[model samples]
Target chain A: MVLYLIGLGLADEQDITLKGLRAVQSCSKVYLESYTSILLVDDFKARMEALYGQPVTLAHRETVELEADEILRGAHEGNVAFLVVGDPLSATTHSDLILRARHYQAPGAEAPTPVPVKIIHNASITTALGSSGLAGYNFGQTVSIPFWTDDWRPDSWLARIGENMGLGLHTLCLSDIKVREQSIEDMSRGVLRYQPPRYMLLPQLISQLLAAAREHQVDFLDPERTLAVALCRMGAEESATRRGELVRAGTLAEMLACTEPDEAQRRQDEQDDEAFEEANPTVSEKEMDARREARRVQRAIDFWGEPLHSLV
Target chain B: MVLYLIGLGLADEQDITLKGLRAVQSCSKVYLESYTSILLVDDFKARMEALYGQPVTLAHRETVELEADEILRGAHEGNVAFLVVGDPLSATTHSDLILRARHYQAPGAEAPTPVPVKIIHNASITTALGSSGLAGYNFGQTVSIPFWTDDWRPDSWLARIGENMGLGLHTLCLSDIKVREQSIEDMSRGVLRYQPPRYMLLPQLISQLLAAAREHQVDFLDPERTLAVALCRMGAEESATRRGELVRAGTLAEMLACTEPDEAQRRQDEQDDEAFEEANPTVSEKEMDARREARRVQRAIDFWGEPLHSLV
Candidate 1:
């Protein structure tokens, strides 16, 4: 049995490679890995359906974990393609699945596992950072900042950024996202609670970073000296914007102060969040925290300066 | 005069979004940032010309550093666009450029620096990793391992990876790419030493990691217990493959064993390098050493487990 894994790059469904498209066409069944990251738009299923003239099954996190054997059951009978968002093997879960398939295929074989698993590579954020004109080699560390509670907020990202600064290497801070669900009331009742599924923004991130910097007394950052770029709506045509700027006291304060929810925009955003929450009630609190942080960061940046960071 | 900054996702001129495409089309001039990362295929100028139906200026590292005023000179005169791979502002260089533009625009409000800068986002590797089925949040710190040298091999990557592992987070290791350079020997003789440019491969990275693990006694990696994924030929339709298996003693040993080079492939690779070296000969010896170490690692992996990494 042959297994074909395909990556759907950022943006819409069409970001997939021609090779991946063909694999999807030829495969008897297709499964889209849903959960890790998401396309800016949710019409990927419709787009792929139109492009491939076939239906695709959505593979949620749980399905991928429990239905591995089922997913591959028909691979031996025909061809099966697993559709991923970016590069197929970039994540360990996919790798684990591939390993599982190999194990199943070679149950009792003395020779190495013989099933052929093919991967269709797509652009990943790692490679995408190169677009920023940053020396790929000069990047110190990539860190993700999750949503934190007043009591349990973690300061790991600060250490990471500090380390990067120490080495004069840049840091790629991946904003967080919340895909699952948690009740706001329940969260509020606890020491820390998430309101809804959210994508972290730049403002929230800056606030956290500033607080951490103060707590640690790491003068590694001078709001004016430390530069930051905030990106939102990645992968879509209207992929929102990327703003770069110095995170200084005035700028940071302005960003945080501007978080007065835009009545109209906030309404729309909340509606979108509600829809998502309704559809996926089991979204974890951790994911929500990450998304919130991402949104906060984005908001902060937008408020501090226009989408583009001010050059000295 | 707003500057529209857009990220062209991956390969193919059409990889741009409708909005981004329109922004480029409307702009009187477009600058393509070419140094940070490159597309798997498609020449920059050719692709931009075909897509925008206009001449596209190339912005190499030097142009970005020396010609900032020139690049932003006509922003107020007409629409101008800066083309970046992946997403704009992903790198600090672009951010700095944007900041500079903003500064000029902020002064004396004579049409606000003539050009208003706008950033158009696209699918970046950061968000794209979600497609890999790896929890984006699960990833801890990312580090780049440059081509090392016998005289000064850096084991920083080992420390970074170890820290990530200690936190049970995955580490994304970016390999090095020598874009422009001369031969090492020529430089020694006061002649321009031009060596072919190169990109680090999976095998080289693995070897170095193995060496570092062994040397540092990083107990986190069991060779067999350590899980690693290599991506080759990223963003190409036929370029992605993944190799994953238990890192066993036999596998490591097999990887370290020698194998004959495919002369034809080697020659072709060298030819590509020669062309790049001819144009730019000031290659760093440190980079070369890192590349060599990476190559050795690649050889081991290729010989050992049939190259479990992927090329896209």
Candidate 2:
């Protein structure tokens, strides 16, 4: 019996490979890693359970970090499957899990046996960024943008992005996700208080990035001339209804506005889909309005689905 | 009808996702993108054909670039599945193919109609690098190492690697693969001659890297202190027989020698598999000699499998 660290690819349950699904189906216990990233769809857990025909326990950060002893014991006794969004080992936490499972390998020389862990690879947003028409090899260091507070604004990521830009390389910016976060005061007082989940939207990220640029006065990237692409619900094209969207804009502001819920619609002919307009010329006025509104809402939610931006 | 750019994940046929496999099954014609990278297995084309129950046409660089008009026309007529190893758009060639497929959208307001291309994502070596204990977020711009030639050697990739090292970021080096490369002399004569494929091995890559370091005199990465890891046949563990090996070393030079044909076998009790070593312990001297010879041959072939190296 071993610990199976499996990756559930970007979109939904069906994104799991046949090999990964087979591991989940027969494992003694199943866990869906929740804190790092979600499956980019509503009811991801339920859908995964339906596919596996087994209940899945949510593995929060604390559960996997502080209270992993129980999971390790279960793995020692029987095979246990731990599913993570994107690639299984993308997050250092999972790698730490594998390391923890091999506690004996740390200090003890030859005393205790170790619990083996097998990794099943899957598509991660890092690689999926190629869909933006930027070559993966051209991408430089990946940076994360955190939500800004009144007093705390860190611009360290700007210099890294500038370095990448200096080399004419694309930068992959991973937007921050505040999931079940606690305030510093609450943590200091030994109180565990929950805050609403927050994902950094493209608009917020771009705005913050621009602010950082202003502070740093860096010329590596230009706000008006820079070409950027944004993705939401990556790898969800096969999903029945809510197929995701990839938005490429001439500038950061344009890309941000492309997903704005209340932004005025660009003329269909002026958009990237003149061909689409040509294909559906007979669409009615009211139907077109409804479709535009629906598309706007969809784009907004999808932008809100998962936040990751790239600049080339 | 659409052009489906599907990723055949790292390794062999079963690595294709159910969604991608479904697309391939239903597509009128299937093409396996042959350049960029090949599957890390023997007879990948025949294997995929047997799995899909359809013949897979090889889409070489020249065909995909020069004669893509025919392929594009076919996609307009019916669904065309273009299979790429690792991920669909990881290579710039596929991205160019997608752009070429949309060439109709590049002209006047009333230009010819354009066909749509949908990309189905899969695990790529970029994401698969997480299998090493390094975080993907720590990787900087990926660089490629080409086979060196007299009077034509280029070392420009060293600066990028040096920049990443300066930032304390890991560099994912994509070694070059020369499949059907034409000599300049042949090209000058308007001759279309083909050369055997050549993949950069660890020894040759390390030698060139060391030479570049000496020429540039960069101090960021130490030849003796830098840690490195090598992988072959990623995403193959779930398959019944082929289990890929992850080689880790404390130094680049040590890692190079790790793949050498000859290294003393560890003592039975000291090795990872006590049983296997124990089972083979005290074999006849003649049998041991034959086993060593066979291991030398196996290492030669495995080093020839696929060409990609990772460092952190």
Top-scoring candidate (DockQ): 2
lDDT of candidates 1 onward, in order = 0.63, 0.76
Tens digits of per-residue lDDT for model 2, A99-198: 8889723233466558888888888888788877777878888888788887999878888888888878888887788888999888899998888787
Per-residue alpha-carbon lDDT of model 1 for A1-312, expressed as tens digits? Answer: 678887776556756744567778898888888766766564668977888888889887778899887776667567888887755665666877777777665444576554567765565555555444455546655677776666788888888777667656667676666765456677667743434456566566666678888888989866555755444433444434533322332444444445656789878877877787788899887777776656655665456532212110
DockQ of 2: 0.55
* Deviation (Å) of B47 in candidate 2: 2.8
* Candidate closest to the true structure, highest lDDT: 2
Off by more than 4 A, model 1: A1-31, A38-56, A73-92, A103-232, A235-257, A260-312, B1-59, B63-91, B103-231, B235-256, B259-312
lDDT of 1: 0.63
Please, what are the lDDT tens digits per residue for candidate 2 over residues B94-194?
87788788874423347765779988888888888888788887899888888788686799889988888887888887777888889899999999998
How would you encode candidate 1's per-residue C-alpha lDDT over B1-312 as one tens digit per residue? 767777776444555655677778898988888776666553657866976899998887778888877777767667888888766765666777776777665334665553466766555555444434566646655666777765778887787777667656667666666655555667678884446556665556667778888888878766555655444333434324533332222333343333335789678766756775676688676765566556655665565433122211
Using all chains and alpha carbons, the TM-scores for the candidates as numbered come to: 0.55, 0.81
Error of 2 at A263 (Å): 12
